[model samples]
Target: MASKVIHALYNDDDILMLAVKKVKAAKHHIEEVYCPFPVHGLDKAMGLAPTRIAITAFIYGCIGLAVATVMMNFIMIQDWPQDIGGKPSFSYLENMPAFVPIMFELTVFFAAHLMVITFYMRSKLWPFKQAENPDVRTTDDLFLMEIEIHDNEEELLALLADTGAVEINISEK
Candidate 1:
């Protein structure tokens, strides 16, 4: 059986919340939600788990720090010893202050750049990729609720109507 998406449109946040509450109370499966702007507590209302992007970013930042430390230590101490400006570079522990700038830069660079890449990759977004937005209006002034249905379109439509949906349409995919 092919999956169907019923799109419900809401103009205001209150109406949207009410609709979401009612749909959730009815135990109907909501496939996705589209909003013009982020709605506070919507993720909790939908029972969605928190994103792990922060943890991923932290790990990537640590990796960057490790890379920067090893590279600097090898270059300054082991590989090519440079005694620039009369600052001894026998070991990073000897003059930890000197490596602070490079460490900070690498940490920021790795965390920001790699976290963004991870987020995009996990979301299946890439360069030159067209986003799959069903309704253009949903990006502006509309909130959409996509409900997946196995059968009983009439029942779903009635539920949506009872929830005060401004507009509703069935998606064929």
Candidate 2:
């Protein structure tokens, strides 16, 4: 189904930020805001919940640590126990220091790779996905703010115009 939306174009990030605040203050639901580059604090401006990716990363790190521990113990102590650098590998505890770097590296590797995949899944982004952006200029130097159209279209048009928007467009999506 197609829904109506308002697209307000802004030439500057500062103007776009102010417009976002005003729109939110007026109790209008903004569909999204697109910018050529990342703008600090924009998420807060949009009143979005804080991301929980850090917690997932911690969990992934723990999993990686466990896998490394099991693999290292099996390979070093159980499979082929040997003496290296005058140190006997009779137990995982005794040779723990030698595996510290491997443990840390594997933890970071798993966390980073898994985190990327997690983020992509959460955002529904993948290879060959069509662009969802409404304006091509938003990928360049322009910032585009999209708002759902309500019954008070005239009021929204005036408000958007006063917010220093370069262009105002009404469309169905």
Best by TM-score: 2
Query: Per-residue alpha-carbon lDDT of model 1 for 1-173, expressed as tens digits?
Result: 56778999988877888888888888887778899999998887887899999999899999999999999888888999888899887777986788899999999999999998998899999889997888999999999988887787999999999888889999875
Model 1 has an lDDT value of: 0.88
lDDT of 2 by residue, 24-101 (tens): 999999999999999999999999999999999999999999999999999999999988889998889999999999
Model 2 accuracy (lDDT, Cα)? 0.95
Global lDDT of each model?
0.88, 0.95
Off by over 4 Å in 1: none
Steric collisions counted per model? 0, 0
